[model samples]
Target: MFYGKYYLLFFISCSPFCLLGQKAVGIGTSNPRVTLEVAGDAITRDGIEIGVIDDMVDADTSTFLVQEDASNKLKTLDVSNPTGTALGYIQEYIIENPNEDWVLNLDTNISATEFVVNTISAYYNRELDIDGYATVPNFSAYIQDGTWRLTADFPSANNLYDNEIGTWTITTLIYSRDLSKQLGTITIPMNNGSEGSHANPIID
Candidate 1:
C-alpha cells in the first residue's frame, strides 16, 4: 500500500516533463526540419571572442584582397584624340577585386539603349580582356610596344584601418602593371611608392 502511494507521487512530479516529450521545441520555426533547426535572422550582440589563436590562420596568404570600385568617374584626358565628335575622356575606375583578375569594361554603366563611344588613349590601346583585340581600347590598353612590369601589392588585409583614405588606384591597383607608363603609382601617406606601383602582369 505504501509503495503504491509513493509511485503515484513520483508520476505526478514527472507529468510536466512527460508532456513536453510529446512536443518538439522550436525557437523560430514552427515546423523544424531537424532536431535543432533554426530559421530566422540571427545577429550577435558582441564581438566574437576566440578561445584559441590558431583559428586565425588561413591556407592562402598571398596577394592582398582588394575591394572593387564603388563607382566610375569620368576624367578629362590631357591627350588629344583625332576625332571631332567630343572631348577626350576615360573612365576612372575605382574598385576592389578579391580574385585580383580585374577586367576593364569600356563602361560598366553603359546600357544597350544608350549610344556612347568612350575615348581611347593615344599612348595605348585597351580591351575588355588581355589580347582579346580591341576597338580603341583605353584601359588595360597596351602601348604599340611596351614591357610588362610588377610592383608591390596594396596594404594587406591585416593593415586595414577605419579611416578610408581617398584612393585612385581603382579595387584599387596593386602589384599592377605599367604598360607604357599607363599604370600610375599608389602613394600611401609619407611612404609613397610609385616606382613599382603598377606591376604589369601578363594574363595567361
Candidate 2:
C-alpha cells in the first residue's frame, strides 16, 4: 500500500503544467522549479527587460550601458537617471521637490522642447511665485532664436522698505528646460530714489 501511494503522489505532482515527463528548461540556473525557471542572467531578444545584464555589457546598445572603469571596476549608467528628458525631469521634480521652484534652461537644444514639450514659437518668457504671485524681484527671462535675456522687478509690492539706502538678498532658484539648479543668492542694493520709482535692481 505504501509503494502504490508513492507512485500516485508522484503522478499528481506533475499533473499541472508538466509535459510528458520531459526535462524542464532551466535558464541561468541548475535547479529549475518551474517549466522555465530563470535564476539569473536572463535575456529576451524582443521582450521588455527591466534591468541590464553584465553578459552583454561590451556590445549592448539597446539597454543601459555597462562598462568597466579605469580601476577595472564595472559601472552601470542607470538609464533611469536624469538624461534630461522633459517629462522625466518634470516628473522627478514633482516627486522630489514638489514645492520647489521649476525653471527652464533656455540655452539648450530647444529642438527637444519643440519635439516633446509644448512649443515656444515666438519670444516667450514667464515668471511666477508658488502663490501664483509675481516674486519680490519679479524674476523673469526671455530666450528666442538669437537672443537671451533676464529681467527682474525688484522692490516689488511684497518687498517695500522705508530705508533710504537698503539692500535685498534675492534668493533666485532656476528651473529651465535644460537645467534645474540653485544659482545662489544675489545682493541687489536698493535706494528709494530722490524721485518716483525705486532704484531697486541697480544695474550699475
lDDT of each: 0.36, 0.39
Which segments of model 2 are wrong by more than 4 Å? 1-26, 29-135, 141-143, 146-150, 153-204
Model 2's alpha-carbon lDDT is 0.39
lDDT of 2 by residue, 1-204 (tens): 999999999879977646636677676788888656777554356866456546656455433333344554434545344562222222111111111222233333334333223222121122323344454433443565644433333322322222222222222223344332334456544455554443454343
Residue 52 lDDT, candidate 1, scale 0-100: 48
| Each candidate structure's count of clashing pairs | 21, 7
Ten residues in sequence with the least summed lDDT for candidate 1: 171-180
| lDDT agreement of model 1 with the native | 0.36
lDDT for residue 70 in candidate 1, whole number 0-100 = 60
TM-score of 2: 0.23
Superposed model 1: Cα runs more than 4 Å off: 1-25, 47-204
C-alpha root-mean-square deviation, each candidate: 21.5, 19.2
Residue by residue across 1-204, what tens digits does model 1's lDDT show?
999999999999998778777566566888876444557544556855646444435653322223234633323332234442222234444434322332333234333222222322222111123243333312342112232211212222111332333222322122222112243345435456544432445433
Write out the backbone clash pairs for model 2. Answer: 103-175, 103-176, 104-175, 104-176, 104-177, 105-176, 105-177
